[model samples]
Target: MSTALKSIRSIAPLLDRVLVQRIKAETKTAGGIFLPESAVKELNEAKVLAVGPGGFNKDGQRMEPSVKPGDKVLVPQYGGSPIKVGEEEYSLFRDHELLAKINE
Candidate 1:
């Protein structure tokens, strides 16, 4: 399938889960100085790009996730599994790992 189709398919069944693509941090300081990778810290905010089917409850019912694609979310700095899609880096985590929905 095409890349666009694949991305769409990945989100179709997302009942409560979400797929996020992290935003790259600024490489330059406010003073226009360049910062190295080691000097930078991981950011907790990200852009939602895909979602999964809702999670299962104790009774087998599906629990819906609150966020959706295109939403900016706050995630744990150290959580989530890293994934590489094509030439880009992405991360996949359960809905629980997302700490909050950032309002913008």
Candidate 2:
């Protein structure tokens, strides 16, 4: 983790809320061509930072979250609460708000 991210470790999500940072869009092509800022598309992928202890199920049993810190996941194009920590921005979402986990 980068030094900036180390500061984020102090924050812990509560009750099934997940904290994530979006993966940065590539600014350069594989062939070494630099792309304009407008040409970079925002990716829907994000890295999980912190996760809350699981939420309670209808039966009152605690259910564990499916994803853990360092896991890359697919997020929705919208929704999720935005958070700003220092100069960096992050997003907070419910466990279910995450679409899928990326293995690569």
Candidate 3:
């Protein structure tokens, strides 16, 4: 297995879900003033790191997740469960939580 697959396998996102790492908000302005956490808007942009096998549909068939690992996505402001992985914070949510895939 590739190193990327190994790292993703270690995580094993559950129930046809995925884990997303949120992009941290910029703290410094163009003027060089540092902004506090409270001053920053809640960020909905994230990068997909791990994904589960597709969820089962009503017919018991699997439906694949549209977003894949490494895809940048837009999530709802309050969706997903918050988790701390190593020293970084991330959110684990079902594929349904994703609002859109960001285009380059």
Reference-based TM-score, model 2: 0.89
Better of 1 and 2 by lDDT: 2
- TM-score, one value per model: 0.77, 0.89, 0.83
Q: Which stretches of candidate 1 lie over 4 Å from their true place?
A: 1-16
Residue 15 of candidate 3: its Cα lDDT? 66
Stronger candidate by TM-score (1 vs 2): 2
Instruction: List the candidates ranked by lDDT, beginning with the highest.
Output: 2, 3, 1
Tens-digit lDDT track of model 2 for 1-104: 12345477788999889999999998999998999999998899999999999889999998899999999999999988887767788888999889999998
Please tell me which predicted candidate would have the highest lDDT against the true structure.
2
Model 2 CA lDDT for position 53? 96
RMSD values for the candidates in order, in angstroms, are 3.7, 3.7, 5.0
- Candidate 3 Cα misplacement greater than 4 A, ranges: 1-9
Task: Name the lDDT of candidate 1.
Answer: 0.74
Model 1 lDDT tens row, 42-100: 77789988888789899999888877879999888786766654566677778887899
Worst 10 residues of 3 by lDDT: 1-10
What TM-score should be assigned to candidate 3? 0.83
The candidate maximizing TM-score is: 2
